[model samples]
Target: MNDTSEKSSPRPRATILGGGPAGLMAAERLARLADVHVFDSMPSFGRKFLLAGKSGLNITHGEQLEAFLARFGEARTLLEPALRAFPPNAIRDWAEALGIETFEGSSGRIFPVAMKASPLLRAWLARLRESGVSFHARHEWQGWTEDGALRFGTPDGEATFTADVTVLALGGASWPRLGADGSWTPFLSARGVETAPFRPANCGFDIQWSEHLLDRFAGSPLKSISLSFCGRTVKGDFVVTKTGIEGSAVYALSAALRDSLEAGANTVLMLDLAPDRTLSQLASALSAPRGKTSLANHLRKKAGIDGVKAALLREIAGKALLDDPAKLAHAIKNLPLRLDRPRPIAEAISVAGGIALSELDESFMLKKCAGVFAAGEMLDWEAPTGGYLLSACLATGRAAGEGAARWLRRS
Candidate 1:
């Protein structure tokens, strides 16, 4: 008589289909409990993240939670739970725990002391590797196979991965060169995942600048100026691009401006060329005798408006307005610059629309597709730069990873 032995069961595998901060965080969270793997389309993980930190890695904001949550605008309520679970303070603690100590900047933005992403990423990756989380780069996800297995286009050929749980942090369509091309939208949509069309969020707007102004003023910075639109005012510096305007100030108001343009509304932005000067003060100063001096020279001497600011006044309000002191003062107080359109989503810092919040539960697990979770920019939420974007991504990533782990236990 021959004896037969029973075969051992295979270990539960958890796959993350993106290697951005969101995917990496999720993998880290699940590494100890399951066979965790992260896959990406790029040659390496966190390319966009590294690019963001090229200047300085803004890890999170140091502001209070109420003010921080307001940065998310309409998505605030939807993202509230995850963000509460892992707020900015928690982000700082996490970074410090990874041996990358953080410090708050003048604007309350938190950054690693090294001021770059590489050190932090390297430390985080080492921790993940030690914990047994694996990464597979250049494996572009191509949706699902006929048998419902997760399919990807590898260098050799198409490959499939079946897992007990899946997390899709494929990011939004912004910065496609960094690997978030948004090719997964159609795949999920076909499978009954309700998604919103992606639109540019923190992107620049196109202005019909005269060739003369474009030739001389393009790339010039509007320093310490205040921009007002839709009843909100943001004071910062923005650069005058060849096509239009961009920078921290413009990006702050971009969501409103983009939405207004999309609704076929004429968007006019009011710029205070001389924030320090009042209308009456400017009028009195302009009314003073020029003594045969050029109007540009007079304006510069009296109002401290010259260079790009002077050119912008003449470009939008015309030279005729300068002749009348009252009109000139009024125009200086409120220079109306009409925005024609928003720059393409590809050039945006981040996009607004994606998988709708309705498509996912509080746990960030896709309702239409069980055992599958989504995080980061892939979800339908948008925030401005200055660390709000990365904070939300990490928060949601942790929530999704925990959700996946819970779902795996139940299944």
Candidate 2:
């Protein structure tokens, strides 16, 4: 029997590929009406998820869903319904229902009281078991069967699985060792799905610095600073990495800068050293300085500037700007930095490209291929970290699951 068809016979079998959050979410959603089997290439589910929990499992933040939905940019409309159906509040509520009560941190990001992703994942896995979802681990996907069945590379060699529908949540190219290595692109292309080239998003940019600046302040941090690019602004801390700058601020603007760099444009990342300080006030303060003291010492002692701020001023503006008080202060208010290139996509926390939206139906089902759906980071969209990744992953998983469920009914 053809796998995509909905023949009137036995219960439809739904196979969810990849065992990350999206795959798991799809399994849970499909189990209500269909026989579900989730397959993962890795030894276990949620390897990268557990790694994220290694720091602390930030599941979702407590911000309003509207603001959270806005984070997705162009993908917002496609993701809105699913997100609204199961939002941050619902996510926290669902977590509480799963025996893992959550709390909002100072940053408004929500996490389990235990503060690790593993415990919640374990609990969720146990729940999925009770919900009757099955898992097939260590089964690397090997594209289509000769008869158009789903084929996978198992430890024993190769095996073909038959299913009524298949949902590919195979994630993006980032964090490949943890399982989502983007090995499914060729398979999708073979099936006639248009794929965009995967690029770095939510990744750092490279900035070459002189040895004098590098050695003096390699790991220094610029705290409580505001950064801007292409009309978007974020207030956070950024660290001076060995290659360039990274951290929350840089990651927030990464998508814009990455796009600019990819287009061969000279991307200018502006930093406001004294975000809260007015140019006039800073000028007055700088002018009152110099009691035979070096400029660095005076700036540090007078303006509470240290670490990356001082290094940045020294590197970008030099001592001439410092000599002219008003100009130096204004420059501090509007310091410019050039971003030459983006870090490798492999090192990015998440990625920016995959199957384009034009290739998918309203149900997230592949337009050309019936009974096949794609979700999570595998879709062509990008958003920064801080729970946005996890939230959308869950939403799209549910969307695909519900779509598959409806398709099974029609079949």
Candidate 3:
């Protein structure tokens, strides 16, 4: 094993793999107490984080603690302690300490005032550097050597390093171009670490749209609509893509839809095209006589449905249904469109599965592997967009760091 420990220093050596939000946060936690080293395969740190914040960096949500914790679904029990330890408010406070001001959107999502991740990341890196944390880019972890030392494949060739403690914050399988490709699975598996097969989450599904619909409204937006699947419904907007639909609303219900398809059940996404108008009101409006107003104009004037909405209605329900007022009103209320399959994981916003929680203890340390801990999207948990994903990752990273610190103290 390579002796990376500094004989001149009293602090123990701590090595963190993956320079994402989770890994960086871990380094920050151990910066002053331990000799910290962070490594990433990518040329720079936070590539995926920067991409996500290109539009707006949603730092966390401003919801109640119970509601926020419930967003994690089944993994809530396992993640509760970490989340409660470092909640959303704590994250805001941490950012403020780094000199980044944040504001809450109308939707209760918190974002940095600068509206981009670069400023926050730059400030964070500066703080880490000031605290004496070392960073190394282009160093991809290649599991362990036969002697159990940490092995990494660097640009210069293979290298080995030993540390008193290690933390793995490698992300789940999504956006391979951004460096999180789930390539660490086999390495952990070889050590008897349990993991769940990854699935596409917060993703769009394919739909066999008619060529006419694609030609006219492929890239159009469906605003002020509600999408329902199973027993749940959400109100938001989604874009009609060349292959299928995607956006906030579609991503909200993607988990259920993906599971149904995986179970070999035929999945259909129900759309309420006109959610604000009542069925009776729409029926009464369509009952009016129209001599030569034209079907499109008549529907538009009567039901306030035009553009892509009108195109979708005609495409799904044939012209025969359009002639019937009651049938047309009902169809508008409950339009059923079949979903073929989910988009590829690379195209998804995030992934669903990773290292199973049962493999780790309360301190986020592996039960079988002493002095090694794991955190971030590499864990077996999934949440929708709207800040839930990032929040849990940051929380888990903090927990892992604290856990590793405790281990170092004991040693």
Candidate 4:
């Protein structure tokens, strides 16, 4: 009477569609509980993740839990549980377990000690493989067959897969070449799963730039500045792109500016050229009698504004405001830059507005499609850069993976 229950029972099959952070994470979680398979449309996995780490992967933020969770904006409450379970410290520890140590930057953003994504990703994939997770590249998910089996368009032909649980981490429409093209929207919609329209997040905005400014400062960096929009102010630096403004500071305020523009409101990004100095102090300094000093020279000497910052003032304020000390000071303190529109979603760092939160259960399983879970940028949420995007993606991926495992166990 030897026990044969273990030999008689087979592990459940779990399929993860998409090989980005979320999909990989889901596969990792399900590896132990089920036969995990990760499928990606791209030829290889983690294209976007590798590119993101090209300049040193900022994996997560080193902020307090409250502050860290608040970065998700309106999706905070929905993502709180997942984030808490796999917070920044956990991210660092997990990376360490993968042989990739991490460090905190001056701004409290976390980065790998190796400063490259390839090493960490390599280790992660190896671990997943060791745990019996299989990888299928060049398999594009094409919704489901009539009988509810997963259908995929492969290079050879169409293929179908059946899984006890499915996790879709197909990401949002940003960096399309990196495999997150938001093509899964229509498929999910056909199944009655509500999704929000995709919009650019952490993206640059277009501005009507003068020829002079474009020629001189098209690729210049505006350092030590503060950008304000709709009463929210962020102190950081950004680059002056040929089309408009972008970088950390602009990305920080892009959500509000993009929303205001979309709402038909006149969106203006106010730049504090000299954030360290007070408005009254600037006014008093500019009021000094100029002994044949050039206006640009005066601004440079009195207010410490030069280079791209000075050119921005000239481009925006014109000569009328430049001559008056009070007006110049006010302009310096609050220089309004009218934005034309946001750069296309393809040019964005990430995307917002994915599967509506209401469509998913507490465990991240789709209420409409049982055993199907959504995670990562495919969910309706947006956050600034500085490690927030990756943090949320990994957390939600883990959550979806765990949820799928739990669902399989219950079934």
Per-residue C-alpha lDDT of model 3 across residues 213-270, encoded as one tens digit per residue = 9999999999999999999999999999999999999999999999999999989999
1-411 per-residue lDDT for model 4 (tens digits): 111112223788889999999999889889989988898999999999999998799999998999988888789988999999999999999999999999999999999988999999999999999999889999899898888888888888888887888999999999899888999999999989899999999999999899999998999998899999988999989999999989999999999889999999988889999999999999999999988999889999999999989988988888788989999999999999999999999999998889999998989999999999989999999999999999999999999999999999899
The reply for model 2, stretches above 4 Å from the true place, is 1-10
lDDT of 3: 0.92
Q: Each candidate: RMSD to true structure?
A: 4.0, 3.1, 1.6, 4.3
Model 3 lowest lDDT segment of ten: 1-10
Q: What's the true lDDT of residue 52 in model 3? A: 82
lDDT of each: 0.90, 0.87, 0.92, 0.91
The local lDDT score (0 to 100) that residue 265 gets in candidate 3 is 98
Stretches of candidate 1 exceeding 4 Å from the true structure:
1-10
- What is the Cα-based TM-score of model 4? 0.96
lDDT of 4: 0.91
TM-score winner among the candidates? 3
What's the distance in Å from true for residue 67, model 3? Answer: 0.7
**Backbone N/Cα/C clashes per model:** 0, 1, 0, 0
lDDT of 2: 0.87
lDDT tens readout by residue for model 1, 1-411: 111112233667899999989998899888878988898989998988898888698989999889999998888887999999999999999999999999999999999999999988888989998998888888898898776778888778777777788999999999888999889999999889988999998899999788999899899999988899999998888999999998999999999999899999999989998888899999999999998999889999999999999999998888889999999999998999899999999999999889999999888899999899999999989998899999999999999999998888888
Please give the range of 10 consecutive residues that has the lowest summed lDDT in model 1: 1-10
